[model samples]
Target: MPHDDVTTPSVTTEQNNQEVLDVFGKHRDLASLPVTENDMPIGLINRAIFMSQMSKPYHRELYNRKSCIAFMDKEPLVVDAAMSIEALTFKAVEYGEKALADGFIIARDGRFLGIGHGLQLMRVVADMQAEKNRQIMHSIDYASTIQRSMLRPSREALARTLDDAGLVWEPRDVVGGDFYHFAAFEDGWFAALADCTGHGVPGAFLTLISSSILTQAIEQRGPRDPGALLMAVNRGIKQMLGQLDGNDETPGSNDGMDAAFFWFDNASRRLAFAGAKSALFVLQPGDEEGEIVDGERMGVGYVDTDLDFTWQNRFVQTQPGSVVFVTTDGLIDQIGGPKEIAFGKRRIRETIRGSRHASAARINEAVLDQYRAWQGHHRRRDDLTFFCFRVQ
Candidate 1:
């Protein structure tokens, strides 16, 4: 190889082959070497074939440490530098030694330029995967922006519909897995607080799927009833699960959303609530102790219901001045303080109760303030979401 030859790998071809053998150990069944001609890969020699010659008593003296091109078998499979890590993994198992070339040749316009190690090849693959994910997340963030934009109703509409409404949401990542939405149908306002399985991109994707399904159900059913809403969403996700059969270990595949949804009829002042694994608190006016409505922590999705699932419909009567708070576990699960203790449900309750003098928005803000103070640190471990409604 020429000294200035960038096409020649920095390490000698023998060293490159030895390094691969070192990483894979003595398992010829696991690795092989590539043969090339005219700067192009031509064939492969697997470990079994290698050992057949190497084990011969006179093998070393016969070849005289010649060029690698002489040992290559006639036909081989070649992978381009642009192949995905996931794709490459499959190809490794699929094509065997043929895909395991000396090193993936880095070429431009059919001219050999450089070489990439297997792990370096995988990293290149991973970077491409991450870039694809980033593009997808960018799209969702845009959709999240649109969804959030649609959430803002006209002042007159709010006054006419919701009593007093506000929300507090902060994501630990670029995209959040927590979701909340309201829809007005025939009888009353339908609202939901949903927590999907994870935190970042995957979590965000599941929530978007859940959100789209829930929205479509509401749109079609015209906000029939909260119980019906939950049931419909459960069935929808179950159908989705049925369609996705290959990956059995996917998060939220076990069970989808942990949520609480309710239909609050302003005209009748009646509250109907349903849930999967979420909790709801109703703070009574002028009192620290409030009526707590606890629902099954089994949000919408497939569940091991034989393990005692009770989807009960509870009716509650609330008077004007009552405050209803819906929260995702992120707030309670925050690891804060010098000791890194969770903010806890107790702190959350006390904070909400103490902040009664503040506006709905202020109360939400105060909860965050209390969280930061309690944590004594920044960086909430999970996504935090809270929604408050005061019965005017």
Candidate 2:
């Protein structure tokens, strides 16, 4: 450690206590002094302890003839000059609480180099940590850009499948685990909204895996059945995460997603839907109540879930003005409000049902406005996603 305020205050064991006290007087900022024999360090002497004892009446006279070895610490923290700051910090704690305040001797090949100050060591460590954080944040921001480009190009394609639509995708963090999928195969199109487990980087990783796997499954299975598509995705997630039954490599790999998927068939003018612990809301023209078609209770690809567990499909016949809505738990399960209750499926149904006469954009706006107001000062619990469309 180098400091402009301090120079090496090294003394010899042959020197008397009075001479060591004179060294402290020369360097008022010095916290501790190294006591050495030849060029090798033997012990450390704290200035505070030595000064307090010497300040007593007749003590300086009594100790003037005594060797400095009498006041020097027999065992002090000694560190290699080339040692990393991180390793040295652990060594300092192990040496005892006094090691930081008293400082350590920086030695090269068992010979004293200089005194290492605790304050300077801490400053270097702090600067290193700050730089590391800045690099991580920069990488995540670039990742956010890539994720957006990957997700957003298919709005025009979806517009052809549905009459009118509005979508909301808000991650609690800047980047999150929630994502929506769109693909076209043969005559019609497919759309899905997925909420993977966890949040931030871990969750963002799943969105990539789930979205890519879902696309591959569509190509192989022909995009006619929503349930089969979901099954393939479930298996794909398990295979990707190494969560298959016989695999013991990743014992802690309990990860998956809750999703609502749709296959819009232009031939039959019908929409087939499947969900993994998800639900869809439908509000038809002139209907007093909107319908909530709940999907299977199980989620996709968790370690505990059965591989053979089948996801069932619900068919909703499309009409010219019928509206469909789907939401992830982040929206319905947000913890806020005066009572801190979940916004709930009941509120969603009420919002959509009340706005049955309005356009998809207007209804979506109303829902978001209500949701934000309800969220108030509470931190978001998870990534929020919601999507809705009017039939052609």
CA-RMSD of model 1: 9.6
Once model 1 is optimally superposed onto the true structure by TM-score, how far is the C-alpha of residue 242 displaced, in angstroms? 1.4
What's the distance in Å from true for residue 127, model 2? 0.7
Model-by-model lDDT, in order?
Answer: 0.66, 0.86
lDDT, residue 216, candidate 1:
88
For candidate 1, list the clashing residue pairs, or say none.
Answer: 276-296, 276-297, 276-298, 276-299, 277-297, 277-298, 336-375, 337-375
Estimate, for each residue in 143-187, the C-alpha lDDT of model 1 and write its tens digit. Answer: 667545544442234446674676776767767777777766556
Error of 1 at 139 (Å): 4.8
Local lDDT at 337 for model 2: 86
Considering every candidate listed, which one attains the maximal TM-score? 2
List the candidate 1 regions with Cα displacement exceeding 4 Å.
Answer: 1-160, 185-187, 219-224, 243-252, 303-310
In candidate 2, how many Å is residue 250 off?
2.1
